[model samples]
Target: MNEDELFEALKATLLKEDREALQRLQDILDQPEKLSQKMSPVLEERLATFKQAFPKEYKGIIEKIISEKLANSKEELLEAIYPIMGKLIKKYTALQFQLLQERIDQKLKFGIWHRIKTGFRSFFFGVKEDEMILNELMSSTIDNIFIIQKHSGLLIASTNNNPAHQDDLLAGMMTAIKSFAEDAFDKNGAELEVITYDNYQLLLESYYSYYFVVAVNGNISSHQSAVIHEKMNNFSAKYLSRDKVKSGQFSQALSINLKSYFFTNPIA
Candidate 1:
C-alpha cells in the first residue's frame, strides 16, 4: 500500500481528464447507435455550412488555376486532337466519294454519256413545250412509231400511213430481226433498244402486252435519243396504261404523239 498506492495517486491526478475522454471514445466505438446519435447533427450542420461557403471561398481560385493551366497547354491539346480529327475527316470523305462513284456508274451504264460531244443548247437556253428542234439534230427524223404484239408478229397500231411492206409484214420482219439478234448475241431478254442501219435506226421499248418501235431515219444525237426516250415513256404512261384501245389500238393518238416529238426538251 505504501509505494504502489503513492504511484496510483500520482497517475490518476495527472491523467484524470484524458482517461475520461478515452473511455467516452471507447464507449462510442462499442455502440454504433449511440455514436450515430452523437455524430449526426454535428456532421450535418458542418456539411451544410461547407456547401454554403465552398463556392464563395474557392470557386474563383479554382477557375483561375484551371484557366492558366489550359492557356499554357493549348498547343499540346491541339497536337493531341489533330490526328483523330484528320482520320475522321478522311473517313467521311471516303464515304462521300463512294456515293459519287456509284451515281456516275448508273449514269454511264444507261448511255447517259452516249453523244456527250453534241448538243448543249438545252443547257444554255430555256425551253417550253419541247417544240424546238436543234439544227444539229436535223440528220435524224422521227419516221414512225409502231405498236406491235408480242410472239405472233402482229401489228397492233402504227403511225406509218404508207409503207413498202404491209403493217403486218413490217411487224413480222422486226420480230424476226429482233429474235435473230437475241439468239446470236445471247441478249438474255434485254430489250433491243436500238438497231442501227446505214439509212435508219430503230429504237425499241417493250411494254407489258405490246412493244414500241420508233423508226428513226438518220443519225440521232444524245439529245435526240433522250427526247425520244422521254416521249415514249410519257406517251405509254398516258395512253398505253389505260384501256382506251379498241381491239388493241390507239394508233391515231400514237400518231399525234409522234408528231409532237422533237430533238430536245429540258434534259432533266
Candidate 2:
C-alpha cells in the first residue's frame, strides 16, 4: 500500500467516527426529556444563586419603586378608604346608642318594680308610699330653726340657745342675702327658697308676718322636702299666734315642743 492511500483511509475512518458522534449529539438535542435531564441540575443551581443574590442586590430598588408609587397614589388611597372609615364610625355610634337604650330600659323596668313593691307595702303594712320612699332614700339632720321678721330682720324665735345678739346677726345676714337675690333678678320676682353650700342646705319659708329658716345637713329628696315643709306649716299654725309674735321670743315650753317635733325623728 502507498503512503497517500494509507493516510486517506485513516482520515476517512476518523471522519466517519466524528459523523456518528455529531449524529448522537443532534439526537440528544432533539429529544426534550434528554435535554432537560442534562440541563436541569445546572439550571437549578443558577436559579438558587440568583435567588440568594436578588434580595441583597435588588431589594432597595424594589422598595423605592413601591414607595414612590404609593406616594403618587395617596389621594386615591384616601378616597378609597374614606367610605370604609365612615362605615366604621357609624357602626360604633350605633353600638353605643344601643347600649344607652338598654341601660334606660333597665332603669325604667326597675322603677316599675319599685312602684309595685311600694304599693303592696302601703296596702298591707299601712305605710304611706311617699313616706316609705323618703325613709329609704333620704338622710338628713335639722341643725337649727329660726323665725325672723320679714322686713325688719328681727329674730323672733330660735331653736339655738346662742345669745340673742348672734341670732339677730344671723337673721340680718339672711335678710340681706334674700334682698340681694330678689333685687338681682327682679324681672322674675321669685322668692329665695333655698341656699346650699357643700352638704348643707338652708330651707326658707315665707309668710305674711315672718319667714322661717331651717338649717339642714346631708341628702335631701323631694319627698323629704315636702315632709319638712308640711311639718313647718303645722308648727307655724299651732305655735305661732298674736301673743307669740308680740313676745318675740321662745318660751321654755315652746322651745321644748319645737325640739320634740323636729329632732325626735327623721324627716320621714
Candidate 3:
C-alpha cells in the first residue's frame, strides 16, 4: 500500500528464507506472560547497573521510552515494545563491540573482489598467453569471476597472434551487463548481486543506483560468495544507519563511484 509496506513486501519476497526465519523469531513476541517473568528482573538489574555507571546514559534511555509511548498514544492499550527495542539495541551494540575488539587484520571480510582493475594488460593484449595463464591459474578450479564494471570499456589487456576484434568482445560484455541488470533489479531492490560464471569464478556486480554498473571478478566459489553475502549484510546492518547526515557520511567513507574515472582513459 504505502512505501514502507511495499518495501517490506519486496524484502520478504526477495529474502523468503530469511523472512521465514524472522517469522519464527516473531513467535517469541507473543508469549508475553513468560517474557514478562523472564525479562523483568534482568532489565531492572541492567538498568540499575547502567545508571550507576553513567547517569547520563539513563536519560537517553528514558527519553527513548517516553518518545515511543507518546508516538503510540492512539491505542487504548499500548504494547511494551519500547523496552524490547531498547534491550535489543543494547545487546546488539555490545555484540558489535565484542566483534570490534579483535585484531583488525584478522577480522573477517566479505569475499567480494576488492578491485576490478584489469587482471593483466599483457593477457588481454596477448590473447594466447593470457588464456594460457588463465587456464593455468584457473584450471584446478572453476573460474567464477564476472566483471562488475569495465574499468575502461574493453582495453586490449593482452594481444594474441590471431586477428579477433577487441570491439566485438567488448560489445558482447556490454550486452550481457544490460541483460544482467534487467534480471537483477526487477527482482531485488537497489542492491548488488553475487554472480557466478561457472564454479571457480565469481563476479560481484553492483549498480550505482540508476546511473552506472560495476563488476569485479574473483577466484571464489558460490558457497564462498554466500558467506561474503552474509558478512556484507551484517556490515550493512551495523553501519548503515537511517539518519540522513549519518548515512551520507558513511556513504562517502564506504561508497565507490567509478563511472567518471573509469571512462576517462578508454583504450582507442
Candidate 4:
C-alpha cells in the first residue's frame, strides 16, 4: 500500500462514526415528521422540568432583567403598561365603590329608633345633622344629562361634561331599554327609574311628554335620586312641552338649562 491509500484508510477509521451521525441528522431534517417525533418527548420533558424549577431557579434572574429593563426603558415600559394599568385601576375603583355602596346600604337599614337616637345625639353634640347624613350617603357627580321625547326616543336636549359622539344613538337605546322593560314586565305606570353599571348610574325620570336621563358617576343615594327627580320635574315644567317635542324642535335653551342645573355645581 502507498501513502495515499494509507491516509484514506486512516481518515475513514477516524471519521466513520461522525459521518454516520451527520447522515442520520440530515435524514431526520429532511423528514420533518420524523424529526418532530424524535424531538417531541425530549422537548416536552425539558419544558416540564423547566416549568417545575422556573420559580426557584430563574426568579432572581428574571426579576433582575425586568428591573434593569424598566430602569433603562421607562418610557417604553410605561407605553406598554399604561393601558393595562388604567384597566386595573378602573376595575379596582369600581369594586371599591360597590363595597362602599353596600356598606352605606347596611348603615341606612337601621331602625327608626336607631335613627331617632342618632338624630338626638347629633343635635345634642352640635353635629350638623344634614352634613352627617350627607356624609353617610354615597356621593355622586352628574356627568351627562339628556332629555328625550318619551314615545319617539328623539333627542330633545343633551349636555355632557365630556364630549360624546352619537347622542341620538344613546337616546334611542335608552328609550328602547325603557320600552322593553315596561313591555316585558307589563309594569303599568312604573317606568324605568335607574340604570347602573360599574361605577356609573343613570337616573331616568319620565314625564308626560319627554324624559330626563341623568348620567351620574358614583353611587346615588335615595335622597339624591329624589333631588334629581324634583329637578327634572321642575325642568320639564319650566321648559319641555309636548307640542315642541312632537314637532321635533329641540331647544338650545333646554340644554343650557340642564347644564346650569346639573353641571354648574358639584352634585353630591
Question: Which is the leading candidate under lDDT?
Answer: 4
Residue range 24-94, candidate 1, lDDT tens digits: 99999899998999999999999999999999999999999999999987745543443344345445545
Give the Å error, residue 50, model 2: 99
Which candidate, 3 or 4, would have the higher TM-score against the true structure? Answer: 4
lDDT of 4 at 242: 57
**Residues 147-258, model 2: lDDT tens digits:** 8777777777777776754877898899999988989988674678789998899988765556778898887765456566666666776676544655455465666777
Q: Rank the candidates by lDDT, best first.
A: 4, 2, 1, 3
Candidate 3 regions off by >4 Å?
1-180, 183-192, 195-216, 244-250, 255-268
How far off is residue 62 in model 1, in Å?
67
The TM-score values for the models, in the order shown, are: 0.43, 0.47, 0.23, 0.50
TM-score of 2: 0.47
The lowest-lDDT stretch of 10 consecutive residues in candidate 2 is: 78-87
| Pairs in steric clash, model 2 | none
Give the candidate order by descending TM-score.
Answer: 4, 2, 1, 3
> lDDT tens digits, residues 103-192, model 4?
655765665666777689788988854445556456777878898988889888899534466778888999999999888888666788
Evaluation by TM-score, superior candidate among 1 and 4: 4
CA-lDDT, candidates in order: 0.65, 0.73, 0.39, 0.74
